[model samples]
Target: MGVVADRVVSILLANGVMGMRLWFGQVRWVYRQRRVWVLPAVIVLGAVALSWLVPYLDRRWAEELTRLPTGEFAGTFDASVMATVLSAVASGTIAFSGFVFSVVLLVIQFGTGTLSARMAPRLTQDWVVGAALGTFMATFVYTLLVSLRLGARVEDYQPVLSSLLAIGLALASVALFFTLLTRVINFLRLVKVLESVSRAGARRAAEVHPYPLGSQGDTDVDLGPPDRVVRHAGRAGVLLGFDEEVIAELAARAGCVVVAVPAIGDFVLPGAPLFEIHGGTSLAERRLRRHVVFGIERVVDADPAFALRVMVDIAIKALSPAVNDPTTAVQALDHIGALLLNLSGRELGITHIRDRAGAVRLIHRCSDWTDYLSLGVDEIRYYGRDSIQVIRRLRALYLDLLRSCPSERLAPVRDRIAAVDDDSAAFSTAFDRAVATSPDWQGLGGPAPIDDRQC
Candidate 1:
């Protein structure tokens, strides 16, 4: 009976730990999505705590400072004068914070309308905007508290330390305000935005596909039709990601192969099939569901394709009739090509998780090369078909990929090149068709090889 009780306690403890982990993961996912307010809230709280501590320290230090020779240099101000200064600082900072909020709103408006609406979330989540707002608010709170403390005292007890610290924070707020303006201006630029998205996409691609293509040997594990299916039991949400190690461990213990039905970034409704368990003892549905994370919207942290999707959105938006900005479309393709180049050398497709005994325990789908290639190129080709500059840039991008990508990847590149030719054929004039079909690395007015002008 003691042994059974001990085993039961251990299982309970394991479940407790897993529960905590799942709860923490959900909180983190929500925080990342809605983190704009978190930093400012934390900073304001810190200021409130500091308001009490700084006055306490100031009282202690004031007593000691009077005994020092340099006490006169500490810039003592009367209580009334210090109160006025603190009030002024408080009023100015609150006004500054309002201005900062206005600027951020304008940035969001301009960025979404002029650039792509996808960038709205990114703009809102920017740390610069959050930090600037937090600093301004912290300064206001600290000064207001200090002033209130001074007013409540009958004796003229000047908080020299608190006054100096408030001034320092005010100065820091000014500096950050300027920095925020600079960042807002940079965000409005098209090239800067493209570079930012491309860099993020490259980082995610590196994380998702760390190894060179074909570096790991592919093993054929035929796990036929599933013996049982595990369906989602929670509210409907987008599948953000899953803990592979945990799922693999669960599958290994059950002596089964688990295949994920929905890929990361897929929206799974309640009662949808989440996993298919093949040839194993029955596992708890709660255990399987806990390991998979869900969120309101897909994020780039797990979805490598999201970056490409954003850049493509920017490109096609530029190519729209109202925008009619083929140059901007070409620039978007520049970054898209860079992201593709980064992915070209990496491993992609179905991922297999193995147990200690080398048995395939978990199988999950990943975006492969062709998916990425089509995503990065097809929309721009279709939208900008008549624009000579866009077509030339597309031709250049395809030819560049043909030369750089591995032999196994060449077929897709050729197919895209053929598609570009078909697009070019729609040009109204022969001269326009010829120029559009030819590759120009600069998109236009760049040297083309004399012998390579077959089109």
Candidate 2:
């Protein structure tokens, strides 16, 4: 009974408004592209449409509208009062919202100087900020129409209730206006932004790969030569995410394993191999691309690497000569290490997709521990070689990772440590080299004896 009830609830939820929002391609595009005006425009349009209905609704509920206590709730809202409030809401909302929006954009622009401009999409697409704008617009439109209902004659359809509602809504808009500024301040802090991105990646990683790390994997799935290649058109953007369930269904219908070529954050080029369809007899590239979504820039859609990418951005910026902040680089390493640790225990790839009858229909291989570690480590080490703070922190990070990860994952870390040692030899003074070369977690100037021992 419980299982059946659960299934019923799941079906209901899937058909709900939120479910429709999640599944719609165009809605997802608005979110990914950060079309800041789209949602608010819809709100404004809806408010205008609703305004037209207010008179009819008020007439239908004339008894309820007239009997409602207007004492203190409407505060002597005459035609002048109504006009004053509506005008303030309409004009003040536009002016204040414009100022806040400009400030936020400026903050994002300044942030791009330190972080990557690629991150700008994130702030622009924020739902809270967008909704704030929408709320102001909605309030303005509603109040304007309600104000029009106020008349000089006592019985000329005053719309007392609608006017009061409008005034209350205007007050609410003022509150939302202040909240938008708060959001702007919080969004300005780069560390906060990076942390949010990392957490988003973690949440997505958890959802997509439910199995624990080093867990059982598909035993025998043929991920051999592809029967056909699905190339992308000339549109370039960050691959945000795809509807995995929908893709699985399409693949099931076609009887093939469609493996995505580039990871989520990769800049997909024109004529690039987007998918390799194994055992696909007559799959159209257009049909397959429909399941994928590419935005203006990378977002934490499903890829775990995006978090690491942001961390690397911070670390690289810190290592740069313009902003010599090794401490910030070290800070990034901590979060990167945590994200890796999260992945270390979870399964990495989708090796097989099965139907209801447990028939294997798809095979894919996502990048494993080695690729992610290299992304987090390689360039920073190359760029920050001269900084003792960076090299030492990396040495400690690797030493800790070496002890924690499975034996096979140790090779890349070990190799990188050796490379760091060589870099230290070529670049470092004797004292700093001694400090960096030490095998311990913090580069304590001791022998790195773990290389000989079991990983």
Which candidate number has the best TM-score?
1
lDDT of 1 by residue, 178-232 (tens): 9988888878998998898898778667655655676545657887788999999
Question: What is candidate 2's local distance difference test score?
Answer: 0.68
Q: Which pairs clash (backbone N, Cα, C closer than 3 Å) in model 1?
A: none
* Candidate 2 C-alpha lDDT tens digits along 229-258: 888885887666555556656777877777
Clashes of each: 0, 2
What pairs collide in candidate 2?
213-345, 213-346
TM-score of each: 0.88, 0.81
How does residue 336 of candidate 2 score in lDDT?
A: 79
TM accuracy, model 1: 0.88
User: All candidates' lDDT scores?
Assistant: 0.81, 0.68
